[model samples]
Target chain A: MKIIVCIKQVPDPEHAKMDAKSGTVVREGVELMINPFDLYAVEEGLRLKEKMRGEVVAISMGPPQAEEALREVIGMGVDQCILLTSRDFAGADTWATSYTLAKACQKIGDYDVIICGKQAIDGDTAQVGPGIAAQLGIPQITFVRKIDEISEKNIKAERLVEGGYEVISSPLPILITVVKEINEPRLPTLKGRLNAKKAEIAHWGPEEIAADKDKIGINGSPTKVDEIFTPDLSKDGKIFNIEQLDAAAEEIVKKQKEMGLI
Target chain B: MGIKVIKEKCTGCGICFKVCQYGAITMAEKVHTLENGKEVKRLAVIDLGKCTLCSECVKPCPTSAIELKAEAHKFEGKENYKDVMVFAEQRRDEFEEAAFELVGKGRELADKLGVNLYALILGKDLKGKGEKLISYGADKVIAISDDSLFNFLPEPYTNILIRIIKKYKPSIFLAPSTTQGRALLSRAAGKIYTGLTADCTGLDVDSSGNLLQTRPAFGGSIKARILTPNMRPQMATVRPKVFKPLDRDPNRKGEIIEEKVPADLLKSTTKFEKWIEDTTSAISIEDADIIISGGRGLGCSDNFKILFELAEILGGAVGASRPTVDEGWIPYSHQVGQTGKTVGPKMYIAVGISGAIQHLEGMRSSDFIIAINKDPDAPIFKVADVGIVGDLFEVVPLLKEKLKRAING
Candidate 1:
């Protein structure tokens, strides 16, 4: 079994700041790291690889700098790394990006499963994984929390719903977008880092993948961002400090009663 | 972008023609001569000039023959579209509260736009349940009933929705930003080639008729207003609990249009295995009217019992901060933060929580907030309507006892 894990390099959301005047995220000074959720996907792929005795290939599509993200995943135990990058791939929405990645998957044939993070922190759309599955014409199970069982032909997994979860089973050649609850990602070892430093990273572009020129980037995206502006947040509320716990409890009860909550 | 049809794979399903809101694709009879001298039929051809490149016809193509080709083209606005439509999400044969909330909001927007408010309900044997939407301010209810729709599958749901949007051409489409809604609406929007704003905190229609979608961005540091002025049937997924449902009116009468699900569109790649209903006593923090949450300050997993007890007495749900969940003190499902669930309870009690920005992002919209922490300088106090500067171990037990006695009385 060959497990393909899709990862992305995102500006550390903690340090990500919004430009109040422009209403756009200012990511220049922020550090870039593997999207926190993708780490779990990579870790799950490695674990599946260890059990299935197959190779784990980590793939990413972003700027040239994103190769470092793929390398880091390789350092964490992936066998290979592939970076899909090109000037033409810039500014693509989830649809176009998934189309390009799906085309890449088709080029990298004979994969049993493809794993992706549930959503990217910056975009938070959570649409790319399912979009890729749609483009590949394969079954998709999103928000997967656990892989209960897996075989060469079929796999069963637990998917997170609103309040609980559902067990879904799909045939082989399926795509699953996983949440952080799946597994704890492991840190890179010294030997793994050494291998990662020397490993060759493959790069693919639209031409290499035989992708349609019109469907690989911004042009292929159906929706366009018309404008972005900051929302007004002007509300005032009073905060009271309480010294006595018993009195505060009685006061809260009275307040609830006054508010008709009781 | 231009829509392309792969001739060899086209099945002439006519789904594309039916789903194309722009009338770009038209069925033309063409005879194809095979090498064996047999005549065959051809599929609908897309006129690039009229194609808005929304790709609405791509997903329902049974043969997967239609592809949206990337090209430098701008989508033209459609003037014929009218009314506001809300996707009334249902789970386990019942409507989610968010569904009613969307309808309520949709009604307001529709009135502002001077159009009818419509609700689209899809499920198995929906029967008379759709009439409930009318009381919630839906001027018309379009119900699509099919056994396959009982459990939400993205493909079939998107296909049916695309069919409806193409046929009705609603100007605005709203859905709950819950798990199922996010999944279904995103795919449906992508298929219909429309812009979708997810997890919207506020939605309003501008005087110019553009939907103003405001959502938290940059880890909830800022709210960004998004506009998809170029697309028809502008789409947005509103967060649950952001709006209150309209009061039910038993006397309210509305039109109900029942549509049959196409048999061919029912074939889905994914299969339903089993729905493991949440049997745990745990309540969805999002739906909880009152929430009592703890953070790393609780020190130990055992300390959660007191918080749970307080929540139980208050008829509330217990939530945890990111650190507590990361420490394995509680499940991630109970986490409240930017990466976890966003909740807006009527009253939120933050015990021992330092109020990280991410944590505050989830619950800042709560009606009223109370904070209890040992450190008076904890940021949680800033957002709290009431602050108790003390040890939680001492204060929590006292409050719990008081609440238990008050409830018993």
Candidate 2:
């Protein structure tokens, strides 16, 4: 089995803070980590590789710092890592990003399966995987929680839905975006770390992947931000720093009662 | 600099830093003593490597501190595009609530743009579903039935959508940003070489007649107004519960066109084996008058019992923040956030939830929000109509007792 995993670097959601004066999120000391969802993709890829005795390659499309995300995956036993970086690729939405990745896959030209996280935590848009499948004209099964069977030619998986799950099967060269419930990702090993350190990450640009200049970057992205702003909740609600919890509780009950809400 | 932060105007408010999904902007501290012996902080710094020139940090800056190079381009042929088309998603003959919401929103936008509101329902045995959409405000409902579309397969769905889009040339296309919506729309947009904004919280037509799609990004820290300026079908997606469905009007007059898609276009490479629907508890937060949601501060899954007990007394449903669901304290169905569900209740009570931006996006639409947490400065306080800075372990039980007595009496 030849596996390709698409991962991303996102701000850690754990270490969140608010600016005291402005009440905005403080971005300082906000470290970047692998998109929590992508860890499952890497884990699933490695697990498949381990079972099938094949290689898994990791790919990330972001700035140079995104190399750290690729390195992390390599340290988790991804056989190869590739960083799809270019000035033109900046501001690319899922459309162009998926296209570029599909082109890279064509450049690699030998892959039985591709994997990605169900959604990037930062964007939470589960579009790129299906977009890539569309760009490559291949089938894609998204929101997969469990893989029941797999081989070089075909695979079966359970997809998460509103009520429960659905069983779906697809031929090889198909793409899949997995949910966190798929597997528990393993930590990087000592040997994996050494291998990652010596591994040469192939940096591919549009030309390197034979991508069209018109379809590789912001120019290729159809969506544009007409405006941007914070989601300011300016409702002047009341705040009670309760010195006496029991009394405040009673007061709240009385207040709701007066308002006819109780 | 892909994007520059002007130091003279920046107040170090950190809004830009938070809104940036790429983690490109970081605060740079430079303290200087003023004549009054007070210190002032410097502005944020942009990292060229990480900045994608998405211009996310440019406008939200109160001081207008950020600037970026503008791209120059020209477009034509969009003048021929007309009307607003919404994909009225359905499954097993039942239309999703989002379908009606989109139709309602689409009707509003179409009226504003002086065009028609068209809805496309693709499912097997969906003969009369289009009428429901018409009652909800669709000017014309296009019903296309096929066994292949009985269950959503992206390839076939996209093919049929592309065919309809090419034929009708709608100025705008809208759908819910759900599992099938995102998968099908993105793939269709890609094949048709158009744009599709995902999970839009707001959609409207500008004075210039462009679909202004607003959405939360960067873990819901900030909102972006997106535009497919030149695309024929300016497409966008919204999550469930973002917009309210208009009251059904059976007397409303509309046309329902039963359409047929080519068999060749309905080919799917993936095979669907079977669907297993889990029997879910009959706890609906959408219709609930009051929702008492818990978070990580509850300590353990066992702590959720406190919220449940309080909810039971209050005649409300139980809700959980994403962390609680992710931690397995509660199921994902009870989770309220961008990824889980968007809800609007009469009153939302947040207990032990130090709200993340994602969590805030879900419940901020409630009529009245009361937050109870030990952390006085939790983001949940920002949106709460009533913020109580107290430990939930102490305040919840007391509040529950008082409310129960007051209600029963």
Best by DockQ: 2
Q: Write the per-residue lDDT of candidate 1 for residues B1-409, one digit (tens) a residue.
A: 3457877777777877865544567887889765566666866888764444444467668888886544444556578788899999998678999989998999999999999998999888788777899988999999988878888887788788888998999999999888788777767765666677878888889898889888775455445566666677888888888788999997899999998767988777677888885644467786788899999989999999888888888888899999999999988888887667678788899999997766876777787888998897676776767788888888888778877787678
Error of 2 at A211 (Å): 0.8
The true-structure Cα RMSD of candidate 2 reads 5.3
Write the residue-wise lDDT of candidate 2 on B226-257 in tens digits.
88887668888886766788999998899999
Instruction: Give the DockQ of candidate 1.
Output: 0.19
Question: Which residue pairs come into collision in candidate 1?
Answer: A214-B70, A215-B70, B54-B193
Per-residue error for B23 in candidate 1, Å, reads: 45
Q: Scored by Cα lDDT, where does model 2 land?
A: 0.81
TM-score of chain A for candidate 2?
0.88
Those runs of model 1 whose alpha carbons end farther than 4 Å from true positions after fitting are A14-28, A210-242, A246-261, B1-72, B401-409
Q: After superposition, how far is residue B207 of candidate 2 from its true place, in Å?
A: 2.7
